[model samples]
Target chain A: MPMMLDRRSVLCGGLSALSLAALNAPALAQATRLRMIWWGSQERADRTNKAIAAFKTAKPDITIAGEFAGWSDYWPRLATQVAGRNAPDIIQMDYRYIFEYARRGALAPLDDYLGKGLTIDDFGKPNIESGRIDGKLFGINLGVNSSVVLYDKAAWEKTGVTPPSMGQTWEEFAENTIAFGKKKPKPGYFATADASGLEPSFENYLRQNNKALFSADGQLGYEPADVAAWFKMWQDIRKSGGCVPADVQALDQQNIESNALTTGKAATAFAHSNQFVGYQALNKSKLSLTAYPRVGKSSPSGHYLKPSMLMSVSATSTNPKGAVDFINFLVAKPEGVDLLGVERGVPASTAMRDQLTTKLDDVSKAMVEYIAAITPEVGPLPINPPQGAGELAFVLTRVSQEVAFGRITPEEGGERMVTEAKRTLARK
Target chain B: MALHSEILSKEGRASALRSRGTFRRILERNAAGYIFLLPWLLGFFGLTLGPALASLYLSFTNYDLLQSPDWVGAANYVRILSDDPKFGAAMRVTFTYVVLSVPLKLAFALAVAMAFNRGIKGLTLYRAIFYLPSLLGSSVAIAVLWRQLFASDGLVNMALWQIFGFEGPSWISNPDYALYTLVLLSVWQFGSPMIIFLAGLRQIPTDMYEAAEMDGAGKARQFFKITLPLLTPVIFFNAVIQTIEAFKAFTPAFIISEGTGGPINSTLFYTLYLYQEAFGFFRMGYASALAWILVIIISLFTAFSFLGARYWVHYDE
Candidate 1:
C-alpha cells in the first residue's frame, strides 16, 4: 500500500501541480467567472438562479455562480467576506445599505457601464436614480415597492364597522378601528398592530409633514414634537382599543407568523407591499392591501416607490465588466425579468411588468395594482436613507418599545431616539 | 579517583548520545502516528488559538467588517462597562439562563438516570430513546419546532387549555416567559449527563448496597450511604461540562427569537448579544471585548465551582 501511494503521488501530484500552475498563468485564464449572492426565500433564490441560468446561455463565457442565505445570516457572512477581501463579485443590496457600502467604497460604480454594455432605457428614471449615490450608480434597484397596510378582508366584513379608505386621516382610521374593536365578544382581535415601535410608520408620518428620517447632513430630520405627537396618536389608539395592548403587540412586531394579522389578533397590520402575499400564505384569512393611513388632505402622500432590493458589484471583483454584464442581463433582459416576475417587487420594466400583470397570480397582481395606485401620490424618495440607516430601524424599535412598556413617556422616547440616532449616524 | 570519575563521565556522555539516537529512531518509527494527529494539531492552532489571540488584539480596535480596524485602546471595554444598557441586560439574561438551566438540567438528568439505573427493562433501547434529545436538541429544526410549540395558539398551549381548563400565554413571545421556555428546552436535553450518571451508577458495586441493606438500612439510607458518596465525581464532571455549555448557548435563542433577540430583548443571551454587536450592528471590536469578558466570567464561575467542589466531592470513594 505504501509503495502504491508513493507511485500514485509521483505519478499524479506533480502533474496536478503543473495543471494548477497553468490555471494561475495569465495567458491560460479561462472564463470570467463571477460569484453573485442574495438573501431571500426559496422562491426568490429559485427565480434568481433561473435568470442566471438563462444569462449563462446568452453570455456563455461570462459564467455566474449563485450563492444565497436567509436574511439574518447573509449580512454577517457578506461582511466577513468583504473584510477578508473575498466578497462575492456581486451582491443583492437594500435601500438602507446602498449608501453605507457605496460611500465606504465597498461597492463598484456602474455609471460608466450604463448604456454601453448595460442599458437603463426600459428601467424607469426614478428606479434608476434610486441606486445612484453622489452621482455614481452603485447599485441597480431590482424592483420598486412601497409600504401598505394589509387587512383580513373576512375579518373586516365580520366586524360590521365602516372600513378605512385609501387616504383616510389618522383620526378617521382610529375612529373606524374603535368602532370595530367595540363589537361584542371583545372582537378577540385588535384592529391593528400597535405600530408605535415600527420605523416605517414613523418615517411616513414625519414625511407626511415634509420631513425625512435623516437630514442632508445626516442628523435627525424631524422635530421632537412631531415624533411626540406621532407616539401620542398611537397611545390614543391603544387607549381606545384600536390596537392590541402594547406588550402583546410588541411581541408581534417584525415577526411574520406571530404578527397580529397572521395570528388572528388583529384585523389589519402594516407591512411592505411585497409582504401581503407572504401573510396570506401563513394565514387562512382572505387578505387585501390599502394605502397606509395618510393625511387625507395632503397633496403628497408621504409614500415613495423605493427599491425593494438592489443589485451591486463588489469593489474587489476581478471581473467587473462581466459582473456588470451579468447584472445588466438580470435587470434588463426580458427572459430574466420574465422568470423573476413580481417576486422581488414590481419589476422596473414597465412593458415587462405590464406583461406580467396578464399572467400574474392573484396575490402578486394585487401587490402590483396596489403600488400602481399609490405611485402618483408618493412624494420623492428621501436621501437614500443615511449610512447607518439600516441600524435606525433597530434603534427606533428599542426606544419605542420602552415607550410601549410605559417605562418612558413619548417625549422621553423622542429624546432617546435623537441621542441614539445621532450616535449611530455619527459613526458614518 | 579523579581518573575513575573521568572515565564514568565519558561513559555517561556516550550513553546520552545513544539515548538521543534512540529518541530520533523512535520519532522515525512513529511518523504515521504523528500524521494521524496532524489534523487535530492544525485545527487546534489554526481554528482555535489563532482566532483567540487575534480576537485579543481585535478587542482593542474598532473593527467594523467593511473597513480596516482602527486601534481604540480600552475604549470598547470602557463603553461596555459604563454606558451600555444592552450589555448589562445581556449579562443579566445570560446569567439568568445559565444559573437556571445548568442546575435544572443536572437535576432532571440525575433523576432520570437514577430511574434508568433501577434495572428497568429494555435498558439499551430506553437509553438510546432518552439520549436522542441531546443529539438533536441543538438543531435548527428542533428550535423551529420549539417556536411553533410555544406559540399562543400552538400545541403546548392547546394541550394546557384542554387538560387544565386555563388559557396559556404566548410562551415564546411573552417577555417574562421567553427565557424560561428556553430554560425548559435546555433541561429537556439532559440525556448526555444522564448517560454519564448511568455509567457512574454501574461502577458502584452491588455488594455495597447489599451490605448496607443487610445492616438494616432502608433503600433511601443505602442510596445516601453507598451510592451518593461514590457518585460525587460524576456529578462534579457533569456539572462543570453543562455549566460551560450553558454559558455558550446561542443557536436555540437565536432561532427562537428569530435572530433579533426580541420580545423586548428578553431572550437575549450574552452570546446572542455578542453576535448582534459583531454581526448585526457590525461592531466587531465591541463584540471581541464582550467575548473576552465572557471568557473571564465563565472562568471565574469554573474556579468557584472547583473551590466549592472540595466541600462535596469525595473522590477517594
Candidate 2:
C-alpha cells in the first residue's frame, strides 16, 4: 500500500511541475532584464527613472534595473563591479576614464551595433568620435558641455563692477574681481572662488597658452614653469582679495551645492556649463554664464564641446543587443531625449535638440545659449586624459592649496606638482 | 540475561576498535561539538583567513584590479618608506590623532564613569544619553554633522559671532586646525570606554574607600591613592583598545575633507590613504602593501603595550 501511494504522489508531482514550467515559459522568454548604472544628483536620478519607465512601457518585453550614485562613490563602485566580472549591462562613463576602461577591455566596442541597433548617425562627427579610443568606438556621447565662469549678475551689478565678458583676458577679469572686492558687498564675500586648484580651469589656462594638460603621448604637455606662472597669477589675485581665502575655498567640495558661490562666500565660481542649473537652484541671486578668461586678445577660447558623460555597454554583458537598443532609445529617440533634457548637458542629436528647445526652462535655456555663444571660439577637443590623470588632478589641488595657504611658494608647489604627476603616471 | 551480555560485548568491541586509532577516537569523542562549530570555522577560513592570505600574496605584485598581478617584490614597501611623501603625511596625522585623542578620551570616559559611580539620580538615563554618541560617532551622518558644525558659517561660528563678536575660520577646512577638530570628535565619543570603566569601578570594593576615610584620608587623597591604583587594569585596558581604534580611524577625516585628505593632507589617516590607493587610484597591490605595513605597526604597538603593562597594571595576586 505504501509503495502504491509513493508512486501515485510521484506522478502527481511530475504533472504539477510540467504545468508550472508551462505557466512560467512565456514570462521567462519575454523578460530580457538589463542593469544600468550612472552617477548624478537626485534630480538626474528622477529624470532617468521617468525615461526608464517610458522605455519599459514602449518595450514591454525588456526590463531594465537602474542604479545611481554620487560622483565620488561612482568610480570605486564601478571598478569593483568590473573587477568582479559582474559589471552592469550599461555604464555611464566619464571622459577621463573612458580611455582607461576601453583600453583595459572592460567596455564593448559599439561600432558593430551602430546602424543595426545603435542609431547615432545624426550625432555629428566630433560628438561621435569623442567616444573613440584607438580608432574603436567605446562610448556614445550623451550630451555636449564646456567649462564656463558662472557668476551672480545681481551681485556684480550691486558692486557697480562690469561682469566678466565672453572674451576677456585673465588679467582684466582679475582687475574687475578686485574692483568688486573693494566694494565689499558682504563682510566676507569675495568676487570669485579660488580657481587655481580647479583642474578644468587650469586646463583651459594651459590651452590658451597653446599647451595642454597632457600630450598625445600621455605625458605632461607643459613644464613646471608653466604651472608656476599659472599659480603665481592666482596668488597675486588672492593677495589683492580678488578671490576667497584658502580656508573658505577649501569648503567647496567640488559640488554645486557646496560651492563658494552657492554658499555666498563668493560672487562667481568656475564650473562646467552643465552645472549652471544646479548652481542657480542653490543660489538666491540670479546666476549667469560666460567663457573662462583667455590668455590674451588673440588666444584660443580653450573650450570644446565634449561629452559631459557617455553611455556604454560592458564587455561582459549577456545581452549587448538589448543594451544597445536601450542606449539608442536614450540618445536618439524623442521620448527619452525629452525626459533627460539638459541635465546631462545639451543633447547631441540635432533632432532632439530642436524638439527640446521649445520646452526647456529658463536656466537650461541659459546653458544652451551660453554654449551657442562660444561655439565659434571653441577649440578642438584634446585627447582623453591618461590613466593616472585623476590622481594628478588631486595632486594639483593639494599643491595648489599649499601655495594658497602660504605654506609653500608657487615655484616649490609647481616643482612638487610635476614630480608627483610624473611619479603617478609612471606607476603601472 | 543473554541480550544484556550481547550488548556488553558490542560496547567492549567498539571501545577496542576506537583504541586502535587515535584520530577516530578523537573524532568520535567530539563529533557533535565539531558539527556545532562548523559555521564559525567556515566563516574564519572563507571570509577572514582566505582573503587575508590572498592580500598577502597580492602585496608583492603590481595588481591594478583590471589586469592580472605581476610580481614586483618589495618595491611597493620600499617606495612607501623612502619615496612617498603622502605616506609620511598620513603617518604623522594618524600618530598625532592617536596620541592626542586616546588619552583625552580615556580621561573623559573615566571622569564620567566615576561621576556615575557616585550613585547619582537618573544614573542609567545619563549613562544611556552619554553612550549615544559612541553608537553614532563612527557613522557617516555624524561625520557629516561634524562638517556642518565646523563650517565657517555653521552653528559654532554663528554662536561665536553672536556671543564673542569673533569671526572664526572654517575649522574643518583649515590645515592648521583640521586634525584637531577630528581629535575633538574622537574625544566626544567616549561612551564605550565609559561603560567599561563603570563596570570596573563597580568591581572595586567599597570597604577600601571606607577604610581610607576612617583613617582621615580626604576625598582627593582617597581617589589618587586608592581608586586610581585599583582602576589601573581598567585604565590600561581602555588605553590599549582606544589607541588601536584611534590608529585605525578613517570615516571622520574622509567625510570632513571630502576624501582629498586636505587641506594639504593634514587629516590624511593611514587607512584613508590606503583606501585612496586601492579604490580611488586602483593601485590594489600598493594598497595591500600598505595594509600589511599597518598590520605590522599595530601588532608591534600591541606587543609593546602588553610588555609594558607588567609595571602599571596592578593585579590582586
Candidate 3:
C-alpha cells in the first residue's frame, strides 16, 4: 500500500510539472507579445485592426494582440483588469477617464518617451499638452473633436424648415426645430433628440453661460438655478414637440445606432462631431454636422477641441517601449494614419490630417472640415471632470427624464440634480 | 487461534504507537475520493470563499479599485443605509420585483405544469419547448431581443396597433412599464419550476385523485383539497429559489436599460445597482457593503420562509 501511494504521488507531481511546462512554453516562444485594448464600434475596430496589421508588417518581431468592447462595457472591464494587475500593454483612454487613471498611477508617464520613440513634433504643442495631468504627460492625443448637432440634411430639407446653423442662438434653434415639428413632415418624427440629459450638451451650455460642469477644485461650478433654467428650456422644447418624446429619446442609449436621427424618430441628434461618420453610415438620409447652438448671439463658443480619445501605455505593462512605439506609428506614420481615417475624430497630427484629407470619403472629410471650422470659435478646454462626474452624468439623465415625464418640476429636478451631484462628488 | 492473537496484539501496538490512527485510517480509506474532490475544493477555497472573505473585509473599507483600501469601519454600510437615495430606489425595485415576479412565476409554472400533468401526448416535446425560454431568458442576447420587442415601434406595439387600434408606450423605455416588461420576461421563463412541479405531481399517487372522484368531488375541489395541498412542499421549494433569483436579477435590466437602470431608474435591481456602484462608479467598498446587505436580506427571507413552511408546507407526517 505504501508503494502504491508513492507511485500515485510521483504520477501526480509529474503531471502537474508537465502541465506547468506546457503553459510556460508559449510565453518562452513569443519574443514580445503586447496586448492592446480599446472601446468602439466595429468601424473603429476595423480601422484599428488594419493599423495593427500595418504595424505588424513594420515590426514583425513584435506581435500584438488586440481586444475591443463597446463604450459602456469598456471602462469597467479596464478597471477590473487594472485592479487585478493584468492590464493590457496598450489602452485606449477617454478624456473623462485619463485624469482618473493617470492620477491613480495606472498609466505610465509618456514624458520620458516623447521625442525618443513618440515623435509628436507635428502633433502641435496644445494638442499634445491636452493629455497632460498634474504637469505630467500621461496619454497621447489620438484625435480631436467637440460637441455638435448631427442632423439629416435631406430630411430637414424635405420638411422645408431651415436646419440649425453653427452660430444660431439656443432660442433660435428651438424655434426653428419647433417650426419643423409644426410642419408635421412625419406622423411620429420630432425635430431633434432631447439633449437636456447629455453631459456634453449640458457642459457646452455651461461654457456658453460662463459656468462650467466642474470648478477647478472639482465641485459644482454652476448653481442649481442654472440647472433649473437648463431643464426649463428643454421642458419648453419638449412641450412644443420640438424634441422626441421622453420615452422614445430614452431608447437612444447615447450610441450611433440608437440615435434618434439614425432611428428616424428625430431629424437631428446631439453628439460629438466624430460620430458623424458612424451616424451617416447607419441612416438612409445624408447626415450633416454643426456646432451646438450658442446661449446667445454673442456668447462665447462652448465648443473646445477635446481629445476624442487617447492612447496610453499601462503602468503595469512589461514593454512600455513597445507600447509607445505602436502609439507613435498609429499617430504619426502616414501609412498607419491612412489605415485609420477620421473615425476616431480627425487626426491630431497636422501632417496626418493633411495627408488623409484628400484620401478620406465625403463623410469623413465633413468631420475634418467641421472641426477646422469650429477651431477659431472654440474656447479653452475645461478642466478635467471630477472623479464622481461620470456618475453625475447619469444623475443628470435621470433627473432630465423625471422632468420630461412630468414626475418632477424643473425646479425640483434641478435641486435634486445639484444635491445628488454634490453627494456623488463628496462620496470620497 | 495463537496467530489471530498475535495479529490483534500487533494492531494494538500500532494503534498505541499512533494516537491519530483512527483518523488516519479513515483518511486512507477515502484518499481516492478526496483526491477526486481536490479540484472542486481548490475552486471553492480559491475562487468562492477567498473572494467572499475579501469582500467582507472590503465592505468595511474605502477601497476604490485603483487605490489601496483605507480602513473606514462601517462608513460604507452607514452611507448605504442612511444617505444613498439610489440604495433606497434599488431596494424598492428589487422588493417589488421579488414580491411580484416570484409568486407570479410560480403560479404560471404550476398552471403549465398541471396542464401538462393531465397526461398529454408528446409531453417530452412540450416540456422541452416550454423550457427553452428559461434556458435562454437570463442571457444578454435574450435581453437585447426583449429590448427590441418592447421598443415603441416594435413587434408588440405593432401588434397592439393592428389588433386593437391602440398605441402602446415604449414598454422598454417608459418608466411606468419598463420594470413590468422585465417582470413579464421573468414570468415567461417559468419552465424550470414547472419541470420540478411536474416531477412533484408525478410523486403523488393517482389513487388519491380516484378516491376524491368517488367522493363526488369535482376537478377544482380535488385540485384545491389534494393536488394543491400535496404540492405545497414543492411550491415552497420553488418559492424560496425563485425569490432568491428575482432578488439577484440583473442581466435583463442591465441590457434592456443599456446598463443605466433608467427611464428614471425604474429597472434598477439591487444587483444591477451594486454592479453600477462597483464598476460604473468605482465604489468597490460601497458595493461590497451592498452585496453584504443583499446576502443578509436573502438569508432572512429564506429563514422566514422555512419558519413559515410549518404553517403551509405539508408533509406525509
Candidate 4:
C-alpha cells in the first residue's frame, strides 16, 4: 500500500506541473501590464498616450492601460471603483475627497515612501501640507491651483475696458463690468459669468469677511445672514446688468466647453487656474487669468493655494508599495508632469514644474505666470468639508437660484439656507 | 428452504411499502417543490432579502458607508418626519408630480392608441416611431437633449423668438417651469400606456360593436358604453404603474436641473431628495427611512387601486 501511494503522488505531481506550465504560457507571451485612470480632455488623452509610449521605451518590461473622462464624470466613477474594491492602482484624486477617503481607510498612507526621499517640498509649506491628513499623508499634490478670473482678452479689449488690475476692489470690478456690458449687443454677450451658486460666491465673500466654510471643529463658519447677504450680492450683480441670468450661468457649469464665456458671449468667467487647458483645447480665442479683485489695496484677500488634485493609493490595493511608487512618480517625475500638463493643475513640485513649463503652450504659461505673480494673501488650505458637503452645495445653489429669480427675498433665502445648513451639519 | 425464501420475499415487500409511504408523504408536503426553487431562494436570501432587511434595520440607525452603522432607535425617523422641512417639501413635490402627470399621460396615451387603431397606412412604422421616445426617454442623451432644448439660449427659445418676437425664459432653469418641463417629458413618453391601450382595444369583441350599432348607439355612445367599459382593466393597470413611476421620477429633473432641482428646488422630486440624503449627504439612516416611507406610499396607492377596481375595471371573465 505504501509503494502504491508513492507512485500515485509522483504521477499527480507531474500532471499538476504540466497544468501550471500551461497557465504560465499567456503570462510569458504578454508584457508586464499596469492600469492608470484619469479625467481629462482629448488633448490630455493624446499627450498621456504619448507619455505612456515614452515610459514603455525606458522600461521595456512595463506597459500601461489608460482610462480618461471629462471633469464632471471623473470623481463619481473613481468613487464607485474605490467602493467596489477594484480601484485602478493609479488614481486621480481631488483635495476635497482626499481627507474623506483617507480617514475611512480607503487610502494607503504614504509616509514611509516620503521618508525615503520621494516627496517634493520646495513648492511651499501650504502646498505640501494640503496633502497631509491626521498626521498621515495619503496623496501627493499633482499640481497647484488657485481660483482665478479668466477673461477673454479680445472681448475686453473690444469693449474698450482695459482688464482690471490685480489690486482692483470688488466695487471697482462690478462698476467696470456694468460699463463694459452696456457696449455688447443683445443675446451675444455679458460681463462677468454668473456666480455658480451661493456657496462658491459665499466662499469669496467669506474670504473678504475673514471667514471660512467651517471652524476648526467643522461647524458652520458664518450665520444665515452671511448666506443671505452673499446671495444678495449675486442678485445685485445680475440686477446691475453685470452678469447673465441664473439660467445661462447654470448651463456654463453643465458643459464648460459650451459655456458662454468660451463661446465669446461673455468676457469673464470664473475658473480654477487648471481650467484654461480645457478652454484652450476647445476654443480658438486667446484667454488670460487675473486674481479675484482685491477688496481693498491692503485686503490680503485673494484666492488661496489649493490642492489642484492628488493621486492616492487605495487601502485595499494588493500592491500598496507599487501604488505609492506610481503616485510618487506622478507628482515628482518630469515625464508624469509632462503627460498630465495643466489638466490636474500646475505641477506642485518645483523641478517638475520647471521641466513642464517649457512644453506648455501660451495659454497654460499665462496661468502659471498669473499664479506666480499673485501677492499671496491666500486663505487657509481647504479641508474636506463636513460629510454632507455635497448636500450643502445643493442647498446653497437652490437658495441662490431663489434669490436670483426673485422668488424669495434675500433675507428669506438666508434664513432658509441657515436652517438647511444646520440640519446638514447636525447629520454630520 | 422454500419457507425461508417466502419469508425473505415478505420482508422485501414490507421494505418496498415503507419506501412508497415516504414518497407519498413528500408528494403531500407542499414545501417539497421549494427544493426546485433553491437557486432563487439562495439569491433572495443572499442579495435582495438581506439588503431589504438590513435597510430596515438601518432605518433605525445612523449609518454612513465608510463607518460601522450606529444604532439610534427611532431618532432618524423622528427627525425626518417632524423636524426636516425638506422632507415635507419633497413629499409635496412627489405627490404633486404623480397626481398631475399620471392622469394626463394616461389620457393622452389612450387618445393616441385610439387614433393608431384605425386601419391607418404604415401602421407598424407609425407605432415604432411613437414608441421610440419611450424607449429613449430615460437615456442620458435624451436628458441632455432636453436640457439644450429648454435652456435660455436653447432651441425652444430660438423658436419662440423667431415665431413670436419674444424670448422665452429658460424652462429648465426657471423653478416655476422646471417641474412643468418634467411633466411634459412624462407626457411625451406615453407610448407604453398607448401600446397597452391598443392591445386592450383589440381584445374587445367586434360583435359587441355590431350589437351596439343595432341597438341604435352612435360612435360616441358605443365608445362610452362598450369600448370604455371593456378597456377599464387595461386603464386601471396602466394607471397604477404610471402613478408609481411618476412618484419615483428622477432622471429628467436630475439632468435638466443639474441635480440641484433648481431654480429653487421646485423640481426636487422625493426620490431625488432621498438620493441626495443617501449618497450625497451619507445620511443612510435617514435615506432608509425615506425609502420605507416611499414603499408605504406606493403600497397604499396600489391597494387603493385594487379596492377601486371593483367599480371601474371590467374583466372579461
Q: DockQ for all models, in order?
A: 0.38, 0.71, 0.77, 0.40
lDDT per residue (tens digit) for residues A157-266 in model 4: 78887676677887788788888878765554788777647355567667777777777787888787777777766677788788887766656553567567875668
Q: Candidate 1's residue-wise lDDT over A67-109, tens digit each? A: 9997778888888888889999999997876777787789999
What is candidate 3's lDDT per residue for A239-302, written digit by digit as tens? 9989999999899898888988888899889999888888888888788889889889899979
| Fnat values, candidates in order | 0.40, 0.70, 0.86, 0.42
Q: What C-alpha lDDT, on a 0 to 100 scale, does residue A118 get in candidate 4?
A: 66
Model 3 C-alpha lDDT per residue in residues B123-145, reported as the tens digit of each score: 99999999999999999999999
Q: Give model 4's docking category.
A: acceptable
Give the alpha carbon lDDT tens digit for every residue of B1-317 in model 2.
66645545775467666657766655655566688999999999999999899999999998887878899999999999998988999999999999999999999999999999999999989999999999999999999999999988889999999999999999989999999999999999999999999999999999999999999999999999988999999999999999899989999988888888999999999999999999888899999999999999999999999999999889888
Candidate 1 regions off by >4 Å?
Answer: A1-28, A121-125, A184-187, A245-258, A280-285, A349-362, A405-412, A426-428, B1-30, B214-216
* lDDT measured at residue A116 in model 3 versus the true structure, 0 to 100: 99
lDDT of 4 by residue, B1-317 (tens): 66545544775456556756666444434343577787899999999989888889999988765566789999987888788888887887788889889999999999999998876999999999999999998777898999888878789999999999888987876777878888888899998999999999988889999998999999999999998998999999999999989988988877776565666668888988887677655567888989898889899999988998998888877
Give the alpha carbon lDDT tens digit for every residue of A1-428 in model 2.
54556888999999999999999999888899999999999999999999999999999878999999999899889999998888999999999888878888899998998899888888889899999998999999998899999998888999999888788999899999899989967788999999999999999999999999999998999889989999999999999999999999998888998899988899999999988878887888889999998889899998988999999999999999999999999999999999999999998898888888899999999899998899888888898777788788889999999999999999998898888899888877
Docking class of 1: acceptable
Per-model TM values vs. the true structure: 0.91, 0.94, 0.94, 0.88
Displacement of residue B134 (Cα, Å) in model 2 is 0.1
Better structure of 3 and 4 per lDDT: 3
Pairs of residues at least 3 apart in sequence or in different chains that clash in candidate 3: none
User: Judged by DockQ relative to the true structure, which candidate is superior, 2 or 3?
Assistant: 3
Q: Ten consecutive residues with minimal summed lDDT in candidate 4 chain A? A: A250-259
